[model samples]
Every structure is written in structure tokens, then in C-alpha cells.
Target: MTTPLLTLDTVACTRGGVVLLENVSLNLLPGEARIVQGPNGSGKTTLLRTIAGLQPPSAGKLQAEDGAIAYAAHADGLKGTLTVAENLAFWASLFGTEDIETAMSAYSLLDLRNRHAGALSAGQKRRVGLARLLVTACPVWVLDEPTVSLDAASVELFADAIRQHLGRGGAALIATHIDLGLKAQVLDVAAFRPAHRSDGAFDEAFL
Candidate 1:
């Protein structure tokens, strides 16, 4: 059996010291994608954040190799002054990979390479952000609403990139409401929410 790239065993997640979800567990294996779904306040983002090591889990065991995961959140993490190619080159340099062609091509950013990221529209910027994932060379992807500003065609482009990533033996854990046409397993995090919402249990915005 193939070992999972990430594993969580009865994990619990918290925000602002209030436990939101517990008994959460899953394995993210190579070539697999898992879609995380739930209501607005049910901790979907929290679970993804915990797996990405952005914050500590309140309880249980979570295991993965150090630096094996790449996380993409609402923010594009772009520098306004840098051109699209420069941004990808910078990220690739950070990961010790110099090839940005594939990343640029994956999101159809070849034409926008010379354009400053700040000059692009929201959807174009979002594409550039998603393209950075390919340059990172990480085996695991942790995404939160990656399609925020993407149009239908751009969404398909993103989906194709994910398929290619999976084909290369990478895995993904995504939090999204829209279907990207991948045969991914679904994890409904609502099942893990605490029965009673404490006064301290704030929305994910606080995270």
C-alpha cells in the first residue's frame, strides 16, 4: 500500500482558544484529492490550516514531512511591483527550482509574463497565484477557496493543473463549494463540529 503524504488521527481544531471541531481524521495519499465541505462556520478552513501547519491542532496526531506541504489561501501573496514572470521566478528560487515555464503555461500566463501583477485583473491574479503551486514542487497542496476570482474557463484551467499535479503523484486537500470535475473524496467537516457553539467559538474570519 502507498503511504499517505499526510495523515491526521482524531485531530481536534480550535480558534481563539475555543474548540470548534474534534475527532477529525484523514489520510491524503499520493495522486489523491480530497474536497472539504461544510457550512460557513463549521471549521473547514480551520481543518485545512491545521493540516498545512499554519496553526497547531488542539488535539491528536497529525503527521507529514517537514516542508512537504504548499498552502494557498485567500490572499494571492503577490508583490505589486514585480512582473508576473518575476513573481514566479522568485517563488521558484525559494523552492530551489528555476523552471517557471511550466508554471506559466499551466495557467496560460505566458502572455502576461511581462506584465506587472498589480496591473492584472482579479481573475488573472488568481491564476498567477495558483500557478505558483506548480513552481513550489511540493507533494501536497492545501488550498482554501482557490477559485475565488476565477471565471469558468480559468476554473477549468485550474482543474487541469490539479489533474496534472495528481498525475505527478501529488495530493490535494481543498475547501470549496463548486465542483472542479475531479473524482475527489468528500470530507464533510460539519460532522466534526461541537454540538454546542460556545460564545468563544467565533467564525473563521478570526483565524
Candidate 2:
């Protein structure tokens, strides 16, 4: 069998001396897409950050093939001063790739190439961030609320791009509250909640 693209074993997290999650385990195989759904403050963002290696888990082991993952967060992470094309060019350079133009065209951002990212609307900035994903040859994508400010058409475009990625043997972990219209395995964080708290108020230190 092929090796799983990602594995998390007995993971736990604590923030500000509070336990956010405990004993969480997951394995993601190539070409798989997992949707993480939870109500507000359910550690959904924390889980994504942990998987992306942005935040260290308080305990447990998380492993992945080096350089195989790319993470896109709710914040577009764009430089307000940089033009859309310049921003993509910078990311592509850092990744040692040169397909920025292709990505821009794919996302229909070619016409807006000269516009500063901050000047664009919320949806446009999201598109710019999403376009960065295409320039990388990474196999794993971790997206946090990728469709937050997108229109219906842009949402469809994003979905289509993700479908193509999966078709190319890539895996994805998405934290979203809405349906992304893709074939994905659901990972409901609600199941991991402690039994005592039926109020739906997530304690930061459940782990």
C-alpha cells in the first residue's frame, strides 16, 4: 500500500494553559479530501494550523512528507503594497516555480495583474491567495475557510480547481462551515467534544 500523505496520532493542543483538543488521531491518504466542520470556537482553525505545522501540538505526533503541503488561511496573507502579479511572482520564486502567469490566468486574475492586493475586494484577495496554490507543485493542501468572501461563480471556480488537484493525486484538508460541493470525507469535531458540556461552548483546554 502507498504511504498515507499525513498522519496525526494522539494529538493534543493547549492555548493559554487551556486544553483545546485531546487524543485526536487521523490519517489522510493520497487523493483524499477531508472536510473539518465545527461550530464557532470548536478548534477547527487550531486543527488546521496544527496539521499545517504552523502551530505545534502540545502532545502527540504529526508526520508528513517534507515539502508536500501548502496552507491557505482565512487571512489572504497578501502584502497591501504589492500588485497581484507581483505577489504571485514572489510566492512562485520562493517555491522555485515559474508558472505564476498560468495560475493568474486560471483564476481569471490576468486582467487585474497590476492592481494592488489591498485595492481588490474581499473576494478578489481570496482569489489571489487561492491562485498561489496553483503555482506550487505540492501534493497536500490545507485551506481554512477558503470561500469566505467569494461569489457563487468564484466558489465554483475554486471547487473546480480543487477537483483538478484531487484528480492529480493531491490530498486536501479543508476547514469550512459551508458545503464545498466536493466529494470529501467529513470529520466532525463535534464528536470529539466532552460529554459534560452539552451547551456547545468549547473550552479552550479540553485536551
Candidate 3:
């Protein structure tokens, strides 16, 4: 039996008291991925954040099957003072792992192992973030614009990594504008666009 990793039923997200997305429903299963695509203000980030537990959904229910999710945002979450190896090692430890070498080579970062994270460029730092995903074994990956600073080759490397993850029975939920080199179910946030109301009679403070 195939168990869904996550499920969102009539999910609605809001920012600044304004609805961004509403009535979104999706099922994500193991070895599967769903790519979120939409305009800049289409609430793509909000949807991913809401599922990642970083933000609260304005309405509807979100359920997770099992295991904690590994979230990698646009930020690298690196400590400038630490070395490339050190930063990844720290994250691995938190996830109950210590093998950093495997992640280092995922993005061709083995050579930069000893380099200070502060000295790496934006792209290098982005690779470091991608490596963090592999440093530990997580069932679900929630990525937002993960390939932003990566080059073509790096993007391919990331794609290959994602394939490997799916092959190992993992699932991913990604919000990206670029091609990730893998076919996935596409969700257009615009479909759930909120209806504009001008009456302004309801007060949200009550909720």
C-alpha cells in the first residue's frame, strides 16, 4: 500500500490579513513530488511555509503521515565563521547523523570542505544548503527556490540528487520557477485565487 506523505485539504493561506491562496487540496505520496508554480505574489512561498510548519494556514487542515520534514529555504542557514565542513557537520548532528562527506560531494563541494563559509560566494553557499538535505535521512523535503543561485551544472546535480532521493522512497514538495530536470505533478496556485470582497464587514481579530 502506498501511504501519502502529506495531505492538504482546502488549505488557505493569508498574509498581512489578505488572502493569498484558498481552497487548495493536494496529496503527496512517497517517491513522488509536487512542483508549485505561480507568479511572484501568487503565494507559492506561503503554501510551502504553511506545510513546513513555519506559518499557520488561515483555514483548512494539513496532515502529515510520518517523520519530520527537512526544509531548505532560500537562505543557506550557514554560520559565516564556520568552515564549509563544519556547517554541514552541525546540521547533520542535529538530524542524528555525522557523515558529512556524502553531502559534500553531492554538489561537488568536497574541495571546499576546509574553506570558511564566509569566503564562499552566493552560489557556493547555495550548494552548501543543498548538501544539508543529504546529510541526514528525512522522509519529506520542502524546498523553496532551492536552485536560485546555482548554475546549470549545479542545477543538474541537484536534480540528480532529487532523483536519488525519490528512488529511495522519499517525497518532495518544491516551489521553483526553473526546470528541476524531473517530472512532477504541477500545482498552479492561481487556481485557488481568493475572491475579492469589498464589504470589509468581517473582523479577523476574532479568529
Candidate 2 local lDDT, residue 156: 88
Q: Considering TM-score, where higher is better, how would the candidates rank from best to worst?
A: 1, 3, 2
Candidate achieving the largest lDDT: 1
- Candidate 2 lDDT over 41-136, as tens digits, reads 878888888888887887899999988899999888899999999999999999889889878887899999999998999999999999999987
Model 3 weakest lDDT span, ten residues long: 197-206
Report lDDT (CA) for all predictions.
0.92, 0.86, 0.88
| Prediction-by-prediction clash tally | 0, 4, 0
Task: Give all TM-scores, in the order shown.
Answer: 0.94, 0.91, 0.93
Show where candidate 2 strays beyond 4 Å.
194-207
TM-score of 2: 0.91
lDDT of 1 by residue, 55-88 (tens): 9887899999989999999999999899999999
Between 1 and 2, whose lDDT is larger? 1
